[model samples]
Target: MGTLGVLGLELVQMDTPPTTAYLQIYTEERCKANCLFCAQAKDSRAGLTHIARGMYIPADLDAVVSRLKMAYEKGYLRRACIQTALYDKWWEDTVYLIKSIREKSDIPVSLSVFPLGDERYEELCRLGVNEIVIPLDACTPGLFDKIKGKSAGGPYAWERHLDGIKRAARFFESVGTHLIIGLGETDEDAVKIIDELHGYNVNTALFSYTYVPGAQLVLETNKEESIRHYRTVQMARYLILEGIVAYLDMRFTDGALCDFGAQRDVILRLIEDGTAFQTSGCPECNRPMANETFSMMYNFPRKLNDKEIASVKKELGLG
Candidate 1:
């Protein structure tokens, strides 16, 4: 795992090591929620150590805290991201980890967890969590219910998650949520929800859905279609966030993004550097290869090269 490599717990090679130390709270029990796509879902048979493409082997808490301090100082990492899964001891584990990290380091911490109460949010803010992410994971309530909400046998509710994100906005300066693409949502659906959240000051991180072996749900998303959809949505997100175009101004035909509704030059100029296609989320969180393969890099960790820029243009129908 990239975090393990940074902590000197393992020898692994990454073309670009994650700028953020991606650590998941270690636990033997499966996550209580049954998000169908997750490897740690309640009824999942997949390895508990796997999250998307990252294999997070458990390590010593004190050692990781020590290395994290070193990594932050040496500029190997700019942030610490702690991922949480629902289980009986999640709160205790999360608190302990945050406290431990705070004890040794002042590096900004990002906590990616599901919806929690204000009491928990206030405590996390007090513990120096710079950002809090409550992942909606789906673009619409129908899709959310089918996969990560109650219909999927999960405890998450769309309304409750939105409330929690809004609640976090009041407590944390940077509030974010995750929305995984390629999960049966239209481009318009993705853009609309993103804009809606943006109206509330919630930043959305985009992820392409991956099929992990032994996971509960097996989906066969069309590769080219998903890529086109993701590229369009990525650029559109940049446009909306930057005020180049509002979601309402965008044209959609049968749920596909037809026109960006911005001047072609404006769009072209923005995409020239390819920050539009980089990983999105809390500041300094470049999740390199977290949901991508070498052949199909959805989110480039660094700046895009000329060839990649050309390819991205073609993918987004810019050229």
Candidate 2:
């Protein structure tokens, strides 16, 4: 029963059987940002326990490497990801850990660190890191501040995160971002952000906001928010990457998605490909059990079965 840390939440062993895919490891100590929604926020005394929700204590560097080696040898884990927080001195430790992991593990490694500069980005790329995740939680800066209020760095500026993503895309082979739903943003805004990310060839992983038990900010997330965001993101992904439609071609009127600007058949065809299903992002980064089970599953985290895809297509009205 190895302990896995996320933000400030520590997870026990898996409640369900472990799948033979990617293994998520908490590779850092505390986070530097106090995103209001985060359970790891310094002032947040939330009793949340989720693997992807927050940062964890940085395990010994050598031991993390050893554990990964042993896990890989036993065929328990395939790809490994190191999810880090934005600690004050976090970058040095993270840089070292990334280098160390590259030296030991033959498996591809991905990182979820803060928005670092071009130099560090290039350094990691040179050291053989394949993917990096920068989580821009809200659609806009004001929303970002409201959602990630009064933190140490105040709130993450949306433009800065975008700039980071742009820089990263130029350097790294795979650049990704995380967008959380239920933050009062409309589905159109969510889609726009996804389109914007696609412009940089940056992949996005979608999340639904799950309230921590004792977090400072007490916002309630609706289950419908997750469903709508998932459906819209799936659509946005196909539209952007497949070049089915442009963001300007879509419009939101009175809270309804309008102006798809493409033929009904074309849109349906793309949607039918199951690319519009919940499994979006880099190769093999499906994080099942990544979010709260009680809420709507934000990302399917795996390939959707036929019935599930049909259900999503029907729900999205992609006929």
TM-score per model over all chains: 0.98, 0.80
**Model 1, residue 123: displacement in angstroms?**
0.9
- Candidate 1's displacement at residue 299, Å, is 0.7
- Residues 15-42 of candidate 1 have per-residue lDDT tens digits of 9888899989978899999999999998
Full-model lDDT, candidate 1: 0.91
Give the residue spans of candidate 2 off by over 4 A: 1-30, 47-64, 70-76, 149-155, 265-272, 292-295
Candidate 2: the clashing residue pairs are 6-54, 6-55, 7-54, 7-55, 32-86, 36-148, 46-214
The predictions' CA RMSDs to the true structure, in order, are 0.9, 4.4
lDDT of 2: 0.65
